[model samples]
Target chain A: EPEVTQTPSHQVTQMGQEVILRCVPISNHLYFYWYRQILGQKVEFLVSFYNNEISEKSEIFDDQFSVERPDGSNFTLKIRSTKLEDSAMYFCASSGGWSYNSPLHFGNGTRLTVT
Target chain B: TQLLEQSPQFLSIQEGENLTVYCNSSSVFSSLQWYRQEPGEGPVLLVTVVTGGEVKKLKRLTFQFGDARKDSSLHITAAQPGDTGLYLCAGASIQGAQKLVFGQGTRLTINP
Candidate 1:
């Protein structure tokens, strides 16, 4: 089965540095999403992208955060300036449709650690 | 904001025992989904229940959506060690965009 894949399973960066998390969603999937889970906290939605534009975003996805499908296959999330609170497991997901019938498929995730 | 509350944040039982995890919310959802996550991995979809009073079974695991569409439950019969993992419930709101609201999760440990 085709699955979403994320690179750099673990990322460590300085507080003020910029970092980019990379993901390759399922080849045939249409909608892409980014979600993060703080340690011991509920997973929170960051952003959703479809038709090459952002469809929705949460408050946590502020000025520092941005997402782009630089190419047909690679979707990237970049944080302009990292903060301690930004540390978490970031998951990339994709779905063939937005409804329940097309359930989301997720990648293992990228563990971002800011110090 | 929508919130999902999961009961008995942690559960530990011997193999062969049956267990149920509850996910509740004050707000209604258009659809509810159950996911299981192993350590260091993303949540994997187990089942999706869209209609009120809907029930779906995956092997020994049974999932049910509330009649009011505000809660759901996962029941595992004759559980095994492989069932040990973090179970999370997420709901899609009737009015919100395509983002899912997740619960804190229930950690299950099935002992041999």
Candidate 2:
């Protein structure tokens, strides 16, 4: 089955440094999302993208965070300056249709470690 | 903001046992989804329940949506050791923004 794919299974960055997490959503998917989970914590929504722009975002998705669909297949999340709290597993997901019924397909995820 | 509260954060049982996990919320949802995640991997979708009082069964697993659409349950029968994993529940509001509100997961371990 087709699946969303994320690069760099694990990353370690220093505080105040920038990091970019990349994802390639399923080719036919129209909606994309970024979510994070601190160890042992609930998965938290960060941002959602559709039509090459941000559709919605959470408080956790502040100015420090940005998402881009620079190409037809690539969706990327950039953090301007990493903070200790930014250390978590970031997941990339996509859905072909409405979330009400269509299930979102998730990538294995990128684990970010900020020191 | 909407929130889902899952019960019995952790469970461990012997093989062939039956167990249930619950997800409850005060806000009604257009749909609810269940996912299973293993260590070092993202959550994999198990099932999606869209209608109130709906029930779906997949093999040894059964899912139910409450009449009010504010609660859901997952029951696993004859669980095996392979059933061990982290189960998560997510809710989508009726307004349909495409964003999901996730609950703290329930971790289950099926000991052989």
Deviation from native of the Cα of residue B84 in model 2, angstroms = 1.0
Clashing pairs in 1: none
Task: Give the per-residue lDDT digits (tens) of candidate 1, residues A3-108.
Answer: 8999999999999999999999999998999999998899999999999999999999999999999989999999999999999999999999887888889999
Per-candidate TM equals 0.97, 0.97
Residue B50 alpha-carbon offset, candidate 2, angstroms:
1.0
- Model 2 CA deviation exceeding 4 Å by range: none
lDDT of 2 by residue, A7-98 (tens): 99999999999999999999999999999999889999999998988988999999999999997889999999999999999999999876
- Chain B TM-score against the true chain B, candidate 2: 0.96
| Top-DockQ candidate index | 2
Q: Which docking class does model 1 fall in?
A: medium
